[model samples]
Target: MKSRDYSQLMQELSEAYAHHSPRSAAIHQTAVQYLVDGGSNALRTIEPFPPRIIAARGAYVTDEDQHQILDFWQGHYANLLGHNPEVVTRALSEAFANGFGLQTGFTDLLQVEVAEMLCRQTGAEQVRFTTSGTLATMYAMMLAKAFTGRNLFMKVGGGWHGGHLWGLKGVGYHEGFKEADSAGLPASVMKEVVITQFNNTEQLEKDFHRYGNKLACFIMEPVIGAGGLMPARREYIQRARELSEHYGVILIFDEVISGFRYRAGNVAALYRVQPDLMTLGKAIGGGMPVAAVAGRRELLQLAGSEHGGKVKFQGGTYAAHPAAMIAAKVFLQYLIENETQIYPRLAELGAKTRKVVTHAFEEEGIHVRFAGDRLTDLPGSSLHMLLFPYQEGLELSTPEEVRNPHVCDITLSEKVLQLALLLEDVFIMHGLGCTTLAHTEADLEYLGEACRRVARRIKPYL
Candidate 1:
């Protein structure tokens, strides 16, 4: 049996995506007049146009064409309790009715409550709120530079901190990860940011030895997202802590994806490695727009007036909006109280999903690797990404390997499968996305069936 061409498969899937999503296609045509690339976020914009979502509930999103697509994106992996969960929404409604919600432009008790919860749960001595992960990471980098009196920073290849100055390099998988992720970033500043490989302790040590003095911080994700769902090896994390301390480099864990997704707090705590600074978002907000930088008191205080505001780390206009604070506080309280039951169940579901989906594709002779399963010393991970191996026996540990086009089928997982799954009325990001509390065994079964059907179509092209 001769295999079909990859381009042919993609063309068929794109045509199907456009045919079933006519309204979305039309909306995208109109949207291009106002929004760049027909969307605001680069991730949300799908090829042949993305589905225009009107409403979301539980594990499904209602598209403009009134299609109920089972969603694995889950509000950019923030909706731990699912879209508009009653626990957070009900609290917001009550707060609004009592005239205590929305942007107050003033300090409120809710902010303090949420901040306290974050500090206590994550072992942070202090915490500050911001509006997005980008701002949280940008401010964290600035704070690190202020504390260390250094201009340089380090990040792993394929790690995405945000669209900030320090985060714009070493993100996408270019040859050697040398290309700038954006155009506007100053070349001098970009040069200061060195790219290291995830879980490669030898390279990490070499880079630290070379750039230790001038580097302000080493920022990375414990459980890698976007670039790959790869989890950092336990030894790698310990070595990073040791090297950062020895080199006077602040270690910042961008736990925005792994923060509450693993447990009620940050995944770093599970590794038993405390970073100097940690940026959190996604699940922390419970679907509201909230992000925070939490760390040692002295470093954070650099942003305070007493220190002459060396960092100037305050968030912009809608930072810590009263409603977002209340939502976060309520969400954290619920997670804390139900920690034992919630996490174990998510772990069970995640394990089941990985197994079911993997078996479904393998039955069709499709080679796939799922990256977000429980790693050494870190358990209860619910997030996932499907990587199609480009060759037999290819290691899937590091982002360098994961993003390398020669090592993995980047287009197959990132595009072709996504569009095919959408045709099955399912939405996933990167590949197979995160499993939230809203997902059920039934949902897993549905996803398995969808994969089996899609694999049948894609197998011919393999």
Candidate 2:
């Protein structure tokens, strides 16, 4: 087994995925006429085609073909309470019945409640609402720039801040994290944005030293999500704070996937590293579409005023839709009240699943290294990283070390394994998952069994 045949594995996974969702394959064929690439998002892809999830409940999603897949992605890492929790569903139903859904012409108390909760949790004096993580981050960055009176941005390489213009650099870099990520991005925008390696203090120092004067903000996640489930070292965070303070630059934490991810989604607070400004999403709405940018009152005041002081920030038509705000209020209030129960359970389940999956891989002679395994283990975070080493003896001594795409290139393998596990009736996204309150010991058992079965199929390659 010099190297397990990737082609054969891909073919097997492809056939299995196609076999599991005949209706999805058929509908996708029709969908291609309207939906680009037969899907709305890039991560919706699997081998051959993607499945149409007709309905979901708890930890399972049913495909159009009547197959139940045990989901681990959990609504793109937002469904911390699991899919359609009874409380949220009941609340949503009532709100809809009361004509609170869609774009209500009048403002609602739900928005105020959710925003207040966010402010309390993240220590932000003011908060603004949005419908997506990208929007929240865009506003956060813009506010940072306006407050600091700077023109450039600094960010962690491989960090995903959204599809917005300023956060696009260094995301898909193969050679350097600072390289231009997208093709159509303006050369000037690329020049204005600088990328630094996560947890790499020297790079942080260098970037801050050079760009500090013109740097609008240093935006990053306390725990990396798409770039890698890598967590920033405390030393790195401290150094970033020092540099930002010295240079009068705003430090913004994109807590989209991390907020309440651990406890109430304020990941920066867990490490006692308070960001100057922070964005919240995902779990905050408990599967609903909601996001927010919150921070110092002084910086936030620069947005939406009669005089239009420095920054101009405001929500869109559907920015704080009543339905989403209602759902968010219910979700956030529930977490705040049951903080002890939910956060600890999430941490426990996360650690247990990691162990179960890792043991199965090793037992089958598979070489896997979970990036940010330790970081996601913190109090309330439940992000799961499945890192398969390119070779057997690779060293993954630090979080940033494993974030390197070359050393831990699971691009193809992640697809293959994602499908392979689907064949085992377990659903996940590129081996990335977040445990929720809905996940149980039985779910973990089922997931571990699925991993073992998939590992058997991939034993040769591992």
Candidate 3:
């Protein structure tokens, strides 16, 4: 490759991005007075300013500046059926119209339906609702300890289970650094957690042996989301199942991003690797904040079946909120009914998109590529495509190479690409791009066009 122009390209793109959304910049500036750092979620707060979304319908979002941009972010990958989907919205509307109360502080009939659907889909013995994926994972870890009578938790090094205290260790891999991701978190909590590299069975064995009888649960995402969209190798997952059984440790799959993204409901069903406990979120809500911790009856029952019974399973004021349950029930049932159509199309779109993007960069003499799960075996098809900017000695032929932290520079590449794509009228989520069913061939063509423009501009940084 020719000497890349990292500085000049960035300066030009920076200026162009600033020019692209003056309204968003203004909005964020005003927001800083009330909202911390101009936004609640640190991830969505972009450098210049995150786009001020005014309206979102189907595959597009209209920014505060009135720019009708085609959106691939899909509400941070929560809108698997696309924004304001008819079925979900209708369900919500009918519930509200029927005098269904919000946060009624009582068991909801909708919860029963939603739980039944989740149980049927995942073959889980029991299901319990939560307000967010963070809570689901946190409760899941607690339940594991309760059931197994163990103290330690094991998780993949670069996995993102949530922002909970126990789940904060080793979120992003920095060579020679194995510390927790946040400040102000108790150092004591990090000690009880053991981190192992994804797709590395050898390291897993070592960690298991190191933790031994104290290890309560081994929790992981089927596809590592934040660090990189790395899919666990089939053999590696099987090994996890085998070891969990041998050690009597509960296995928990954090499917917050993968639930229903692969084949209607869960990756475990698609991959045939069952876990003792599973956390479901993101797409299940269709836009609302909803999640659930589901698993074997024996394990979940340890939390207590009756009110004030044995152990506290956990109950939030917003857990199983009637509106969210109705929406989730409608979305999950629809997805299950249309699984044959929805999943394959998503996988195909992912494969086609990877080709379009890679080809776009190649044409500009850029060596850019997406990192994991290529072609039909779309393990990372949770609508989040982890971009791998060109790097040396990075293997693309196998799934086992997920542990290589140098697979790409996500921090810089993701930020730059988001700005570039935004300026091109394509809205991506923190540069973690996604695809929705509402995304058509024309939208894809626009994506390719935008990528071609971005690649040419980023030629110096290649």
Candidate 4:
């Protein structure tokens, strides 16, 4: 078989995309005059400009070009109940109708209500609400450093905790996981953050042995997001817990993407290894911007008034906004009440989509593997990411392997496939993206057919 020409293919796909969505292209062109890179978020800004979405509901988003595109990005994988889920929206509307509003910057009963729900659901002794995953994770790290009196922290390569200071290193694969993700970060701060390989227990143990005494914390995602959406092994998580305990390091689980994803609460519960602190976001807000750092009382109390305000994590002005809190409360209640039905159905749909899409590509003589399933063969994934490995027999177990161009066709999956599918009126991030409860069998069928069409169109490039 001939090698794929990803650059040539991307050029062709970008031309086709611009031709199909002229309005979006024009909107992006206008946006570039103000917004950096024509967007606030870098990931959303793709080649030839991204489609300017005007409205979104259920499993589809309407672009400015009047195209109703089938969406799988699903609000950065936060829309478990789909865009503007009625259960959450109606509750927010009712709150507004009852004279409630947003961002008053005062403590309200709604904050306590949602915080109590989170504590009860996730086995956390305390909870502190924030506005985003970045702030939440940053606060968690600060708490860890303050409590442990250590400076060094450890995170796996390609694990994206957000755009915060502690999260700026070892995130993207483009630099081969060697340099800081951003340009302005201090070298002194970046050096204190030790990097480790995901799911590699031996390397983790070695690092812990070398830097465990000086390390304040070891933060990781149980279901590694951005890195590949791959779940860690049971033993690996168990070992992490054991080592953190022995080394006096605060183990922090960054569950921004995984929390409330596999179940009603945190995915840490599934691993049976509770970290000292867990950062929650994305799905927990019910499509609103709400995030939190919750865990043992002592650590969380560092941010409290009684503790002399060690961490400075009093939260921002939008912390526990009334409407967002109500939305989160209603969404969590619905998820808890329908846990058995919601989770199983999500897993089933995700598995079905993965299998069908893989089959679609295989029919066109294309070989691809997905990185959504658990290493233990567990059937609980609601995310699917297709990867084209360099060889037929190689397994994608780590972030390096998943993002390395020599090991896998990173450009083919991230850029070429993305542009190709957008022309088919389908949107995906990290390949197939996440499955929402609002997605139906018919939607899955549409997605499968779209993949098949995309495969045939791009087959000759390979």
Candidate 5:
């Protein structure tokens, strides 16, 4: 397949949106005022000129202009049960009637219930709640360091844990590491972090040999979520487990994205290798802000417990808020009850979507790839040239290309952009299925139709 002129296509797309709807214009204006200083939280995944979503239901979101869009993004893969699921809403409503926030007693039984369920699911004897994934991982790392009497921790290259300084420092995106994603992280902090290339067992062994004693823990995502949807090989994960046990270094599976979606537990369940600690987020709260660090009781007992007369502190005001707990409990119950049927259905949908998408791209003469476990998958389609567009006289690419390419862009730029716009429009009307428990086979058809529409548009370009 020949490469597309993404520069020219993007130029035309920008012109097409020059006179957007008044609602979209208003949203853009408001966003500029409200978010410009702080910036979008997940800026890399969103479009440069993102539409302001006014409302959402199931798998579709309505923009400020009242245009509905099929939401494959799914709140950065958090909405496993889909937007405003009845179970979540009902739980939230009941919990709100009981109370919103109280600093006093445990008025919520759901929190404990969910934690117990997690323990059963993940094989962790104990669990601690946090408000965000970052906090969960931060606590996990601190606990590992304290328990092991070591300061250094090994992390995988191109993997993202969260925004916490220590966690972010462990990521390979910083200076001195292979690639640093963020700036302002102190150089001193980066030095304590040891990073190894993903999927390379030799490097893992070498790092362990060099710094095994100094390392407090080794943290990684079972499936690389933010770094790219790269699933760790089973053998590599087993090796990590063995090395951690041999070195007395805590093994932490940062399943913030992989938890509950791929299997009931962390990817450890699939590989039959249990880590000392595991961090969970995303679907844990069923779209609410919740995260957790679960591990052996001995490790978790250090929280607020005197270990040789020293106490480890970990607390947050909203750590176990009743509303969030209730939502999580109901969501988890639904998941547990329907595990047999729901998981397989989602897997089937994912497989079907992947197959159809792969075939569509092939037919369109676009180079692309699809990746995911049973529940979800990501398409990394891109124009191979965009990686070095400037080398071929093309200085810029589409807003999405600047962020993430689908697989390849061999089709004509104009046609590809048009197809994207058309797909966005179609998604607005029919409401694409997210492959949630609520979504039927018909919904999958809608999703396929959306893909087919885009495929047809790029046929000529191919």
Candidate 6:
């Protein structure tokens, strides 16, 4: 099929998006009245308002304007069973009927059940529930520090653990710290964190040798989700484990996005490298807000004051809320019952989609990289990408010549975003330009077709 002119197509779609999205516009106006910067938050992962979603079912969301969109984003990779699945809804409903919140110790069965399930799946001895992934990691750090009597921590560069000050320090966004990924965090607070590049064994060994004594723990995403979905080499992870063991540093795996996606365990399971502590979230609660820190008995027991704990404090009123606990339990139950069928199916679908999209980009002469292709035979979830425009032999040219060209002024990034938005308009949504289990073969074909169309549209600029 002949591709349409993307710039002109974008202009036309932009007009249609404005004119046809009256409900979205009204929702955006109302949100702006209450929320700052028109109801937006940090990360700016999603496009700004007229950003209104009215309803969602399995693999689909309907905006306020009633445009049914194919949701590859899948709630930032949280909805493993897909949006509003009957199983999750039933679990939530049952938990709500029992009670939303209990001031004192009420029924602890749900919490216990979730912990037991996680332990069985991940081979962890104990688990602690938390309200969010940030809290889970923070508490894990504190526990590691308390158990080992160390003050400093280490994280791989480009890995996002959470929004906490320490986790954000090595993200390359903060100016005051040596490397800060986000602003507003104090440089003093970040000094305690040491950064190491992923897959760089020499640097990791050197850093461990230099700071192992003072380092409390080393935390990293088994698969770097936000850090462009970079997967660590097995040798790299195994080396980390050896170094940590050698130095007495606790190793923590932040599996927030990986948990319950490929398998009930995680990337750690796939890599066959065990960490001292594993943090989980995203799919654990089946679309609810929940996270966990699981570890060996000695480490987890540090949190309990009754056991002569050295760890300070970790629990909150909502730490083990009945609703979230029940949701997690049901989600795990579903995973256990359908593991053989569900996991293989997701893997097959993911592989096919990656192949189709990669081939489409190659045929169109677009410079795009898919994480799914890079991490093939690896049992994990989430299909992500890092896209750049083909530079037209610009690499061989001198810096001056490359910078002098005004044609390069219009970035490939703008075109990519425009194409993504166009896909959204036609009912295919991406989560920060990534796909997930919610997508089927037909959905991926839809995306591939969209890419072909987009390539044609941007051919003139290229």
lDDT at 164 for candidate 2? Answer: 84
Candidate 3: the clashing residue pairs are: 4-460, 5-460, 260-265
Give a tens-digit lDDT track for model 5, residues 43-78: 321232555677878877787777766665566677
Task: Please report how far candidate 1 places residue 283 from its true position, in Å.
Answer: 0.8
Residue-by-residue lDDT tens digits, candidate 3, 124-171: 989988888999999999888877789899887767788889988887
| Worst lDDT 10-window in candidate 5 | 381-390
Kindly report the root-mean-square deviation of model 2 from the true structure over all alpha carbons. Answer: 2.1
What order do you get sorting by TM-score, best first?
4, 1, 2, 3, 6, 5
Residues 1-462, candidate 6, lDDT per residue (tens digit)?
132334654565556566777777667677767777565554322333444787888877888777877666677678876788788788677656776644345656778888999999998999988888888999899989888988899987656788887787756423212466667988676678998766567878999999998999999876776544556767778999999999999999999987777787767888888899999998898887789999798999887866675675465667777767767788889889989987887778766766676677679876654432344436444555434423443321111111122313223433345434444553323222445556777877877777667666555654
For each candidate in the order shown, give its overall lDDT on alpha carbons.
0.88, 0.79, 0.77, 0.89, 0.64, 0.69
- What TM value does model 6 have? 0.86
* Residue 86 miss distance in model 2 (angstroms): 1.0
Q: Which pairs clash in model 2?
A: 259-265, 260-264, 260-265, 261-265, 262-380, 262-381
TM-scores, each model vs. reference: 0.97, 0.95, 0.93, 0.97, 0.82, 0.86
> Which regions of candidate 5 deviate over 4 angstroms?
1-5, 17-22, 37-40, 98-107, 169-177, 308-313, 372-423, 426-435, 438-440, 452-462
Off by over 4 Å in 6: 1-16, 43-45, 48-50, 95-107, 172-178, 307-309, 375-381, 389-419, 422-437
lDDT of 1 by residue, 84-188 (tens): 899998999998899888676889788899999999999999999999999999999999998989989999988999988878888888876766889887878
Which residue pairs of candidate 4 clash? none
User: Against the correct fold, how does model 1 do in TM-score?
Assistant: 0.97
* Model 6 global lDDT (CA atoms, 0 to 1): 0.69
Candidate 2 lDDT over 1-462, as tens digits, reads 233458877887787677767788889889889988888788885557877888999988898999888888888888988889988889999978886687866787888888888888888888988889998899888888777777888888778888888877777756656667677888798778887778778978998888898898999888888766656778888888899999999999998988887776487877787788898888888678888889888878888674375666766778888888878888888998988998888888888878888888788887786765554225434777788877765545343455555677565346777778877878777465777778889888888888888888877664
Worst lDDT 10-window in candidate 3: 396-405
For every candidate in turn, the CA RMSD to the true structure comes to 1.7, 2.1, 2.6, 1.4, 6.2, 5.4
